[model samples]
Target: MDKIFESIEEWMRNLLTGMVSSNLTNMFTDVNEKTGDIASQVGQTPQGWSGSIFSLIQNLSDSVIVPIAGMIITFVLCYELISMLTEKNNMHDIDTWMFFKYFFKMWVAVWFVSNAFTITMAIFDVGQNVVNRAAGVINQQTAINIDSVVTSMETAMESMEVGELIILALETLLASLCLKVISVFITVILYGRMIEIYLYSSIGAIPFATMSNREWGQIGSNYLRGLFALAFQGFFIMVCVGIYSVLVANIQVSDNVHTALLSVMAYTVILCFSLMKTANFSKSIFNAH
Candidate 1:
């Protein structure tokens, strides 16, 4: 009965390991075997993962966000009118210039509400241009030799001995589990940014409505700055990952399978931490505050 159970467990472990190894390419890889591991994967990700999510957000912004912004514009215009007309003696001293000024503000606010998504995309475009320039300079000097680690693990797993198979199976199981968790963590970061892009787009006009006022103009200014920060943040992240890939490519994995696996795990943990901090780091660079 014990042997039968072990056989079933081993089969399940094989399935899990297959799934993990298959998906690892999404996070770290170069499909073009010619291109060094880091550059290929880093460059590919902008168009690959969460890219469609960005498109979805853009569509949603145009369809749902613009109308909502129109309503906010209406309220703000009404409030501004009430304040300007009722302030002290403005009603008694109604002037032609005041009417012209309010008319201009209303026209500008309407334009802003209508074009919120285009403006949001334009900010992202600026950021993407910066990243493209940065990527143009990013190259891997040397490649890390991790193929041997996979090779060795595979060779060990092929052994006929039951005890060794059990041990290796356990290692594969642990690695697969870690990979699944890491995949989810990375996915959230990538997709979360797209959601943020839509959020910034949705209420975009509220800030633009105040752009004519000296004090309130800063709000629109800051929003654009933050949007750029979000867009360019990916560039920095890609650079970091590329550097990490180079480091990983060069790591000397010894014959000790456990040590090699542990080293890989350490690298992965550091990557996740670095990625999590990229948003704040890029925001600082753009002075989004």
Candidate 2:
């Protein structure tokens, strides 16, 4: 019995280790591929392709992809809950097949936004002069002071004229708003298509399974309502973010404590508001259905 138990334990340990290692390997491979793609898009190569790819991927995943994924997941889960509640009320249809299709499309849209580093770079002009200076630095062809360049960029927000700052903020807001609008429209179309498919499939399976024209109209209305609610939530978050940016741009607190405290408070408030909005919106969507 003791020998058998010991062997079982050993087997379990190996199985667990293998599972973990496989997951880690897949994660690293994904990062490597994404980083290589980004590097190629940016027209630059790191010292060693593999090492640089890993580092770049790590940084991008940490700083951008993870947060975006979290937000998308949160939205998707909330939407699912909303669907469940509406289905419970028997107010509208809840087709799992349709839901899956819509969810998959939304996932694709979110992925595009998450991986949009090139779009961001183009919008912000982040590496234009930096690239030129870097080329010069590499070839020893120019005497550009790297430290001064860094300081200047950092200080630009502070020293910017009021009009210029406002314009910059507005531009950022517009770009984000445009992207979000496109995303929402895509989501709506995807959902609509899924619903059509579901209806057709049901009708084919059962001759009397077709919904009335009124029911179809109700579904359309409910979806549009949900879409608007989501858009409003996105707008609210963006406004908060804009305020945060302005605060960061204007405030030059030397004391770390003061900065840290204010930032924490601001972030906490934003988080609470966002959560409340998400929960309420989920309820609303469910009620609509």
Candidate models: Cα lDDT each: 0.62, 0.38
lDDT of 1 by residue, 1-289 (tens): 9999999877866764454344333223431132233233333322343567657766676676666666666777888788888974968988889989999988987887677667776776676666655555654343443355555445544543455445555664565566557656766776676566657765676666656555556887888788878887768876666565666565553355556556656766777788789899988988898
Off by over 4 Å in 1: 1-114, 132-169
**Residue 145, candidate 1: how far off, in angstroms?**
5.0
Q: What are the per-residue Cα lDDT tens digits for candidate 2 across 224-261?
A: 34433432333333333334333333433223323422
Clashing pairs counted in every model: 3, 0
Q: What is the lDDT of residue 161 in candidate 1?
A: 49
* TM-score between candidate 2 and the true structure: 0.24
Tell me how far the alpha carbon of residue 234 in candidate 1 is from the true structure, in angstroms, after superposition: 1.0
Candidate 2, pairs of clashing residues: none
